[model samples]
Target chain A: MNLIKLAWRNIIHDPLTLFLNIILLTLGIGLINFILLLNTQLKDKFEKNLADIHMVVGAKGSPLQMILNSMYHIDAPTGNISIQEAKPFLREKHPLIDKSVPLSMGDSHKGYRIIGTDHTILEFYNAEIHAGELWNNLYDVTIGAEVAKALDLKLGSQFKSSHGFTDDVDLEHDHGTLTVVGVLKPTGSVIDQLILVSTESVWAVHDHDHEAHDHEGHEHGDHDHEEHENGHAHNDNEEHDHAHDHEGHDQHEHDHSHDDHEHDHEHDHSDPNHHHYGEIAPRRKVNDLSREHLLSQTEKDITSVLVRFKSKTNFQALNMPRNINENTDLQAASPAYEINRLYDMMGTGTKALQLLALLIAIVSAISIFVSLLNSLKRRKYELSLLRVMGGKPAKLLSLILLEGLILSLLGFFIGMIVSHLCMSAMGDSLYERYNYPFKAWIAHGKEGLLFTGTILLGLTAALLPAIMAYKTDIHSNLSEG
Target chain B: MLSTKNLSHSYKGTQAFNFPDLLCQPSETLLVIGQSGVGKSTLLHILAGILIPTKGEVLINDTSLYKQKTNALDTFRGQNIGMIFQKPHFVQAVSAVENLFLAQTMANKAKDTKRVHTLLDQLNISNRATAKTYQMSQGEQQRLSIARALVNNPKLILADEPTSALDDSNCNEVIQLLKHQAEAVNAALVIVTHDSRLKDIFPNQLELN
Candidate 1:
């Protein structure tokens, strides 16, 4: 009976065309919203994590890869640079350098990167301890907030690190198990996705991998002398001595954990007390590795160093990256510059998708217009009858316009819901791969504009048809029948 | 009562029409019979306030129909005059009851479902009250239009070619119902048709050449 009711009824009566119009509009709006979410969230995450690190110095490779690996932790590192090589930037008070934090990355536990770093990294990211304390002893690890929640790691929980940033069991280091000493509060930055430990912990784990053979040789010599004094020939010990003389030395090659090597060597003999120690080899405290002791041998290398400049002056800003990249064997990259380049590359694709979505919306608007015009043409007599029965021109005009508004509003709502669901589905996979905390349900500010734009499109498409309804010559139209 | 004096309308290139003076009191039925091109429908439309005549004015219940502003005139038409077209027209989306309700709403009357029901019952369409107008038998559609026209209890009722497609018996039944409904509301009735068979039926007649 009311104008709106009548308009709604008319739209329902033509279900096939109604479906076409609404579906087109929904696809247009949904695609646009989806593209908006991806662009905004990715930019937010990339920029937020790029905290004042003016340069990254690493082994010579792609500068972008160095930035991504060091600053964002999403790509493979560009090899390692010797501690002695990075020593200048790592100094306590350099004129041009405000601070430099070394990152020793090459390991992970459950797909979360274990980044061996100092306490200053916590300051750089503005992160705070949520529980327990910072890692101070060898094999002690501090976890990110997301890492703790995702892996269900509590203080004192222990896990062995894999050799690279993946959870492949084959690559799990025979290095000693690392104990959780602390959990960090989330800073909405890359720190929330990293596991941090003292840089010496990384060197110590690698040292154990290479030195297990040397310790085996020295221990074998002492045991041989003891056998000679006791006048006893242990066949297993003889076989071990024979195997150690060969070049392969496959037993200790993969059994690189020092404790595991000692356990294996002791297991060949018949000392009950030593056998008990063998059983607890993985739990043995190999805790002597400290930052001072490890850096005393400056040949030990780190993955990269994140340097913040004292001032972003024109001279240093223009010269620092070039000096490091050209003069030294290390690759130096500006995190901000590389990230901006990345955003520009991605922005092109996002703009294209936005344009395509806009085109679809325009086509959808036309569909609405054509369908409404057709409905008006078919229902001219009905309109005239309204005019004859005390309906005004404005009433008829609004009836047609109401049909368009109602149709587009339905399309807008359904489109938004569909886009959100699609985003949530994609967000889970993206988070797993990149560790970016993408909140899929957060509607951005442009969506308010999008809402208004969609309504205007609907109304604009309905305008001409509504005016036609308003200007209908009722007598001529009625008498045509 | 309804009356028209010196009423005429012209198209852009056609000769102008000159209409005779006419009068009909409340509860009285007047039939205007003519051929297809005689502009009988035009005269009815002018009287219904659907057309502005080139000359002269139509007066209904002593109020000149065209004297009010366009919207006010429309509201006045809704409140006081009812016109049925040659073929029944309806907002095809709604049921018979809803269409009658729409008619009363358009006329600026508070929705009177009881009046609609009573009219549908009198027209023998109460059983089809919830059916869409287009889905009904043609006879039922015509009766629905009658219900719509009388829904507001208007002071004047105009029917244009009300029974052109009907048989003699059906035509007689339709005219009688129109006369009865008009008399029940004490409204003036004007019937315009190219159907000459209706010339002898009404007591008052106006013939358009």
Candidate 2:
């Protein structure tokens, strides 16, 4: 009965035009929303996992790949550095170091990377064992909440791991079956999708001296597997014997009193000439220690070392990574620097997509204008009749304005729904592929601005048409009709 | 009551029109008869406050219409004057009853569905009240327009050639309907038309040359 009611009638009089306007506007707004939601979540995930890790120490390669591998677990490691090479930073009492967790990767279960680190990794993720207990020994595995849910792993479950990062089941390492000791609670971090095991477990899986490896008779010549395996055995021996063999591989074979064991281990370990720290722990003779064991503990190499500074304000912390990069063979990469570089790379695509979405919105506004203008011309006499029925010129103007607003609002709502629908669809595939969570409904400040812009677009498009309705010559139109 | 004096209008590059003075009391009916292009519609528009005459005043209840601002004039017209076009036009999307509701609402009057139903029932078009305006026949549309004009209970009703498009019998029926509605509301009625038949029906008549 009011101007708005009349405008509603006028719009519904031609539903096709309204539908067309809504579809175009929805597509534009939906695209904008989709891009915004993705970018926000991606940046958030990157920033969250980049928490407090000042530097990544790894074998020389792409720094970004190193950070991506160690911090986010999204890429392959940049080869491994020997324990001796990483000794200073890993030392508990080192001046610049607060804590250091070593990671030994290059294995996967159904494409989810199995990360090998100490108990500190749980603290790093702020994770809790929601069920059962954390891994306590070699071959004892604890899965992330997401990994447990996705792979349907449970307490007391056992699964053999495959060698290297691959989805193929054919490359299964028959060395040992990792027992599921725990399932961590959801931390909303990258830890949710990781399969966590002790670094010793990683070395044990590759260790040849284990009876299981002899039973399998697999050639242990794969250096990546063998070096990492001895590191695992040394870790085991440290746990039982308190040999404190945290630094060198010689005490590993010397403790077993195997000169034959020393022969194979010495082949790789003796290239570096240095004092064997593990041999010093047992007060073993220098003649019993191999030179290779002096450079690396257990003759093993780990993927990377995650370093936390004693204090961020410490000057030594600032100088340490640089010294590691310039003076040592190992490379240092900062998660913050590499992630910012990633954002810079993705920013251009986001901006271009945003522009395209805005252009679609503007074009939809034009369609609204045209549709209203067309309706106005057809309803000219009807409008004149309204004037004759004692409607003010302003009333007629408001009628057209209301119609435009209704169309815009309808289109905006439909656009939001469409965007979320697309997100849900894309989110499912993305989760399946990369384990990235994309929630359907995510409202932000930018969307609020988008709503305001939609209203403005609607009202602005109606301006000329409303003015035309206002200036309509009631006398002429009535006479002609 | 309705009155007009020295009412004149001129279109750009066209001849000027000079209208005779007029006066009518409440419940009075007047017909201004003219040929096409005699500015009969122009006179009706001026009386309805839809057009501003080049010279003169249209006084309703002795208040000069031309003396008011555009907004005030519009409000005054909405509340006091009801107009029926030559053709029975409407907001075609709405129902016949809704058309009456529109008239009441536009005049800043509260909706009275009871009164709307009563008016349509009185006009004998209550059966078609819920039907869209386009669905109604010609005579039904005209009667609905009459119902709309009377819905607001205005002080004056100005209809332009109400019978011009109707047959002989339909024309007589429409005139009787308009007169009865005007008398029922106690309003002055001024109808301008080129139809000669109306002159026989209305004793208060003015002829435009």
Give the candidate number with the greatest DockQ.
1
For residue A290, model 1's alpha carbon misses the true position, in angstroms, by 7.8
DockQ of each: 0.76, 0.66
Q: List native contact recovery per candidate, as a fraction of 1.
A: 0.75, 0.77
Task: Give each model's whole-structure lDDT.
Answer: 0.78, 0.77
The B-chain TM-score of model 2 reads 0.97
What digit string (tens of lDDT, one per residue) describes model 1 on residues A214-297? 434454444533433233222232333322211112122222322222223321111111211110022233243333443443
What candidate 2 gets wrong by more than 4 Å, as runs, is A109-111, A128-132, A148-175, A183-186, A206-298, A310-329, B12-15
Docking class of 1: medium
Considering the two chains of model 2, state its CAPRI-style docking category: medium
- Per-residue lDDT, model 2, residue A214, is 33
All candidates: TM-score of chain A: 0.83, 0.80
Query: lDDT, candidate 2, residue B103?
Result: 84
TM-score of each: 0.87, 0.84
